[model samples]
Target: MLNRVKRFADKTPFSLTTPNPQEYTLFNQAILYGVLIEPYFTKIHIKHLHAIIIDGYKLFLSLLVGIVNELYGKLVNSGKEQLIWVTKEMIDVSATRIDSLLVCLMRQIVGGDFSNGNLWLCFELVSLCLSKWDCLLQEKPVVLTSALYTFLRLLADHCRVSNNLKPMMLRQMEIEFFVKMLRDQFQLCLKIGRDLFHVPF
Candidate 1:
């Protein structure tokens, strides 16, 4: 099935399906299920996929994020962790491919009705990101930064509820560790730049 889908994607002429109203839905579902079944996202560039969509990047991103949230919900809600461990692994791999998924989602989800829609998705992603911070920082530093920045930006924008949520979020993020990490990286960058431009003393 996977091979067939790939072949179809690769061989089909874009013009033929260009006008189909359901094309984006079909593509989104196929990609979502493919990722769930075999974890095939690690090698693909999300931007490339975004370019192939008929409906525009916003709709594509919305569908992608919706599936991602669905995936997270299923993984967390499933009773047997041992059996569902592979599902978690798949989710992690997909994250590596599109490191900015959650960050990008912030733009897609901001607004008046965000509580159940965008806010909920952002909360789920922030929780997952905090839980996996150490590993994500080591393997995908950009993703970690993007996720943290997005969460912080949201807090700044929504002062009322964010004030109550700030302490919990900071605790989960291990504020001290993150601050130290940022300082260390900043110092390293400065040292590198200074050494590069240094003159004989």
Candidate 2:
């Protein structure tokens, strides 16, 4: 994956500071990010994960958040990441993967082919967690507990109670628990409560 990115880079003659033309916006960034990090979720290494997250993770996450915010601003006034709330057209039937569909849906939300978020990062974390949900819940359960609780909160916020939110909420629970595990791993150890993490603030 990195090799493919390098090939693209070689052709463009641009620095990492320059977002790859393939990553002009949130939607494009999703494809590149998905191609690069999605594969590593199966068996992630701390060192490599560190490189991926810290290298430009902030920029990536911020971009995804920006996309969500853009959609919220343009379509819905709720100021939350609600697919149906932003664009009812998100409910489409397709054989494509959910994450890929998320990319496309986001593009549509931004209106006229636009997406500017780090959705792939979120997808990577959620997918990884779901893959190990049971084990993580039993083993590294403390953080998983926190993550799941938060996931539930997000589910409640997104679900209107009018729609059948249970299934989606359950899936999100798995993904959220996964995110919590990853978060407790080391992603936010540096940026979070530095004192709690035993780092000088």
Candidate 3:
């Protein structure tokens, strides 16, 4: 699939002119898959995608949302890493529906799972939220609220089950995330309502 997409990309010159809609979608799908499956060549695949992207990355992001929603757990470790990297890239570009993509990733961080991958995801996401705090608040405050609720809930589970250093580190990160949200966006935290009170400290 990557080879075929590269062949098409090589033949096609970069232009703002839209290609056939169906073909364009197919190419995006192929490239998205290639990005996830070929981590070593991610930059190359991303450059090819940028050359052909004509939809503000909406189609590519939507395809990514679907993958994160349906296949995140099944993805290999490197694939998961690439997925998060591409997500950060999309955030950098301020892609459309990026909030939804973020929410999808938040959902993928399963609570009470002390596995390394789960802990890593929790850390990565919390760090992403912290790093992009201003952009997220300005662009989609609701995603911050969602993260607040998610981490608050996860903290409860972590407190109950965690005894190791990794989980401890993740718990600390989650604490920082919600605390920042509450300190800077108290009113937004209020939107969480009764659930906020119910989360075990």
Candidate 4:
């Protein structure tokens, strides 16, 4: 599948004239689908995408946001894993609108839903924020503010199920995330002040 898309992309003239925007978008869409669906060949597919990429991954990132927004709940487990992995990769490279992608993923964490999948999403995202704290603070501090609000709300819900082992673990992680944000980025947390009072004690 990737090879066929590569062939189609290669045949499209890019240097002689501006590549057709519609065709370029189609190529990116096909590559994004391949990356999500073909786990075994993910690295090779990403490499292929990098080799042919003309837009610094803007279109690719947009397609990912679309999938997260429209099809995240129905995605298979492996596909979800790949989605998270690829999102981290995009972050590492500082893809455009990356904060929007992170915001979309954060919104997918359904409140009051203690399902494993939902908790897993929460864990992955919180961990991502923790691990990438400095980078995010520099590139897009607003994302952390959004995360702070989302997790504070989630923490309130997570507290209700603290007896369960999974929620307990997740709650602990959430605490660590909050501490790090407040300890290191106090002013940013301060911006969320009045809203903090609204979250139940």
Give the top-scoring candidate (TM-score).
Answer: 3
| Worst 10 contiguous positions by lDDT, candidate 3 | 7-16
The weakest ten consecutive residues by lDDT in model 2 span 86-95
> How would you encode candidate 4's per-residue C-alpha lDDT over 87-200 as one tens digit per residue?
988887888889999999999999999999999999999999988888899988989999999999999998888578988898888888887887888888878878756654
RMSD of 4: 3.4
lDDT of 2 by residue, 168-192 (tens): 4444544455345446554433323
Ranking by lDDT: 3, 4, 1, 2
Each model's lDDT comes to 0.45, 0.36, 0.84, 0.83
Give stretches of model 2 more than 4 Å off: 1-55, 72-128, 132-146, 153-201
lDDT of 1 by residue, 118-155 (tens): 45555555666656666666666666555544554554
Clashes of 4: 0
TM-score of each: 0.41, 0.26, 0.89, 0.87
Error of 3 at 151 (Å): 0.4
Off by over 4 Å in 1: 1-31, 34-88, 91-96, 111-114, 162-201
Stretches of candidate 3 off by over 4 Å are 1-17
Cα RMSD, each candidate: 12.2, 14.7, 2.3, 3.4
For candidate 1, the 10 contiguous residues with the lowest summed lDDT are: 78-87
